[model samples]
Target: MTQLQKQRILVVDDEQAMRELLTDLFEDAGYEVSTAADSFSMNRALEEKPCALVILDLRLKGEDGLMLARELRKDSSIPIMMLTGKGDETDRILGLELAADDYLMKPFNNRELLARVRAMLRRTTELSLPQIRKEDSYSHQRYSFDHWVLDLTSRELFGPDGAVESLTYAEFGLLEVFVQSPNRALSRDQLLELSRGIEADVFDRTIDVLILRLRRKIEPNPKQPRYIRTERGLGYIFTAAVTQC
Candidate 1:
């Protein structure tokens, strides 16, 4: 790729060897790479230069990578791919709920990592493109449901009182899928494919966690979620009536 076309990626890991490995891996894949050993350096790197994606390690030296991911999500919509240990399933699930876009278990294949990074970058680029097909209901449209307004063009959500609600990149994508197909039952596999174009494997549970998080944000009562409801053996459904403008 030409320099103008090369995307930038930030790899945040405490270990030097791991950081170097990832930096080399992504750089060889034709991306501009930056490395940060901790939150301080990570913040500095982000402030100094913007990156297309952030690959965050779940375990950082004396710092909680989950907290860093949450902080990043709160401030920016930048895509985050978490690197996690094999036994950190709870942490991995929590990371997703906190809106990390994707996660890869430790000892992951380098090719798989590159593929995921490409997929994520492609998704983000597609969302930000100025020109989209007008006939595509999911693109450049505003969807209203249960007093909330979702503006796909601006990628923002407005509450009933007209306050802007903060949604991470992953949350927004999943919510968009639901609003576009309101009142339809979507299984975990379908939701995964529709939202992120990933298959349902270990990520089926991740879908459930994301649903729980979305309910907490949009449903008046997450405990008895009126907007998104479970469909018994059929996964979940968006029960709210959505109108598009």
Candidate 2:
């Protein structure tokens, strides 16, 4: 297949051997692969070619992966899979909070890695198809809630002040789910099923983290969320009226 026709994936890791291994693995699986040892190289590659997803290491030579992940999410909704050695619970939760779509431990199996890459790419494609159709069918593709506007095509959030807010892929997915079902209490399990497909390994806490991130963007006060209110033992509900344009 032509390079341009293949799905491209970027691997950001400082380890040379690991880079080669990942490149070989992805290429063997019929994907175009690019490697970057640091943020600078990663940025250069991203600027040069569109990437389907990024496999970022948690630790770089002189940089932190979490920080880089946050920086990437601030502007793009590209799926990120964090690679970490420590496997600490805090790091896992924090990575998810930063909108890393998924993660793998250092000693990850190659098959598992392949499975994750395929799953993430599939979900990304599924999420994008609706936006494309909406853009073509509607004059203005936006979802409004509580004076805030979310551009469905651009995946952009605009506040009442007309300022843009950055939302990670997961955060946006959760928000979309809520907006489509406002006033109904959705449990974490239901949310996990709806937003992340049928991925059973997805934790319930991840839904909570995604909710917190979404509230920070849509709620007038994240501390006292008027739109997304917790239902105590049940879960959370989007109480605000949503209008689609």
Candidate 3:
């Protein structure tokens, strides 16, 4: 019988105690775990191997986890879950805005933490799988809208002039949902459910933050979005006509 390899998770924290705690926690939960105390080591670990998810401490001794998350999101779609001792709403929102997939405060329940980690990994795996288009009986890899092309296979967004715009995993997922359901007002909850799934422990603001990020990438003027428009009380709608290719 072939045994499946365990999924790997990287835990980044400045405190040795916290790192060891998480290492033990995840190892007990049947995941292959690695620990890093700083950004340098974290980057090196990721470079040397692939990780299914990252658990980052928001407050590091000499590093900023939010900045690290931003840098990570620039190139990789690896899911990130942030931990903070502080319960400041602003910091939480800022972390989400920078593309951190999940956030948890200190004194978190071990069970809840594990559950969230599982949810994130499951969502990542689901998104990576090829989807069969029911309408055409063939998979469509690219979606074109308003002179922009979103290639699902490549996970790249190409601008009108042929330049490529960088999109975080969350950004790409939200954009995918919008392009697929064009002209419909999707509530924040619906958007979150469609993009991340029903099991995601995300707030409504997370969707709003992702929408803002997508507008910045795809809108001619994010201030006055032409494609993703807001509905007074309903939610948001993608006004562009999308064509699958």
Candidate 4:
């Protein structure tokens, strides 16, 4: 019998000992592990093969891992677990603020690290699954709202002029939650759970950022959003009528 292929994980740290440690640790747990010492090598590894998650060190030789995390967010929704040193709470907070999936301090227990990795991988898989429509028989499905159409299958958005507007994975996930729960005021906590499936580490700013990005694409006037509206002290709500077909 052929052995099952393992999910690939990229570990980026400038320390050779830490890199070797994680490579051995994850590989022992049946993961195909890869290591990079810095952003350049990390990018090259990502370009060469798909990685399910990245374990990055907050302090690199000359590069800021936080900035690298931000760049990764712009292009991919791959789960990121930041590794921080002692007394680095400020950078940890900034990492969460920048929308990292989770974080772990240096000298973390191997058991806890393994658990977090499994949990994050599960959430990533959940978010990547295509939502099931009521009528599964329909092949090309779309959700229409306020002159904008979201193709559920392709996960693409179309403007009133019928031009396709590109959407990142995070933007699409948050929009899917809002559209499905139209006219309901969803709090940051609720949005986190509904959108990402991992709520413990989620921050309010992350949800706010996703909402702003979605409004730019779906709202006629993003400055005065007609679709997604803020509820002051409450949260946000989708006001337009959403029709799925």
Candidate 5:
């Protein structure tokens, strides 16, 4: 049997030991690994390498990891797992709100870290596949879901007061997929296939991050997302009915 190919992982930390340790661990487990000490190095590596998952440290000297994650979320659907010493629940929540797919506290078990990394990579792979649909076959009606209106023609996501909010290409793709298949459960695998373009190497849990971004822009209460409903293990569903334009 051909061994399954390993995905590349980027480890960003100011601490040299942590970066080296994670690099060794991931490499030992069959993954290609890269390390970055700060945002500048991270950007340089990102440009030179292709990573399916990023294990990031939230605290950095210049440009915090959270800010970096936000910037990354703006362009790519790269899965992010934040590593930090922060033990506060509030910090974890904030990390999630900022689009970190998972949070790992400092001094976490190595085995547990590997497990979470594997799980995150797997989930992202399932969400990054390309999905097919008839060209121009999809249509959406402008309607109120939470505070935003869906404009199919403009392909724009609007805020509650009809204001335009910044949405990255990945986020727009996710929203279109959900709106096109409203009330239907879209599995992570399905989403991954549909969302990742032919040449894109990024994974799908980026889908979840994009969804969170969309909800933050539209939903009055992101915790209780009115439009994009989590379907537990199945993935997600646009619970709010859409009227086709």
Candidate 6:
């Protein structure tokens, strides 16, 4: 790929050896690679370089990577993957909650890492492609649904009373599915594939967690979600009529 077309990757790890290894790997993959040894340096790199992807290690002296990931998600949608050796279910899930796109345990295969990098980049293609047709009922009139107000021209979600809501890249995808299907019952597999962009062999819990989060903001009563409903074994249902003015 030409220099202009190469993906820009930022490697954030305090270990010098690990940083060199990742920088080499990404450069071999025809990417523009940059490195940071800590959060301060990482932020400095981000300010100076236009990074398309970030490979972040979860541990560092004086700062935690999970904390770094949260701060990054607050402003940019740059894809993030967490590298960690800690093996705990709760920690993995919490990393996901903080908006890391994926995680790999230490001693990960290079091939697997490459595959994930490609998948995350491939999702960029959908942003350029034409959106699929939505149900006729989906509209953006004078109203509020969930925590968002409608942005008519852009058709993006806004905060209630007209402020812009800070939605992560994945959260926007989930909202897109609901807007398109409104009032339809979609299975966990369907939600995972349709919204999260995972191809196959997806664990159902991912969709469940996403739904739980979306409900907290969108539903009138999160405990008894009006926009999203559980259909027992059947899956989930979104019940909203989006209308435009």
Q: RMSD of each candidate?
A: 3.0, 2.8, 3.4, 4.1, 8.6, 4.8
- RMSD (CA, Å), candidate 4 to true, equals 4.1
Put down candidate 3 lDDT per residue, 1-245, tens digits, no spaces.
Answer: 11256889999999998888898998888898889989999999999988999999999987888999999888887889999999988998999888798899998888889998998887676556544332442454889998999877656688999998876667888898999999999998899889877766777788888888888878889999999999989999999999987
| Candidate 5: regions farther than 4 A off | 1-4, 131-214, 217-239, 242-245
Q: Across residues 46-135, which tens digit of lDDT does each residue of candidate 5 receive? A: 999789988889887666778889888777768788888977766676776676666778988888788767766765654443222213
| lDDT of each residue in 1-245, candidate 4, tens digit only | 11345788999999999999999998888888889999999999999999999999988999999999989988876888899785555666677657576778888888878877887776566545655542453775678887888876666678889997766555667788887899999998888888766634445576776777677767778999999999999999889999987
Q: What TM-score would every model get versus the actual structure?
A: 0.90, 0.85, 0.86, 0.75, 0.60, 0.80
Best by lDDT: 1
- Off-target runs (Cα >4 Å) in candidate 3 are 1-4, 127-138, 152-156, 161-164
| Model 5's TM-score against the true structure | 0.60
Clashing pairs in 3: none
Q: Is candidate 1 or candidate 5 better by TM-score?
A: 1
Residue 173 shift from truth in candidate 1, angstroms: 1.9
**Highest TM-score scorer:** 1
Residue pairs in clash, model 1: none
Candidate 1: segments with Cα more than 4 A from true spot: 131-139, 199-202
Ranking by TM-score: 1, 3, 2, 6, 4, 5
- Choose 2 or 5, whichever is better by lDDT: 2
Pairs clashing within candidate 2 = none
lDDT, residue 238, candidate 5: 89
Better of 2 and 4 by lDDT: 2
lDDT of 2 by residue, 1-245 (tens): 68666889999999999999999999999999999999999999999999999999998999999999999987788999999888687888899887688878889889878987888887677656675656464654688987888776666678899997766666767777888899999999988877776743566678888888887777778999899999999998889999987
What are the lDDT scores of the predictions, listed in order? 0.86, 0.84, 0.86, 0.80, 0.73, 0.74
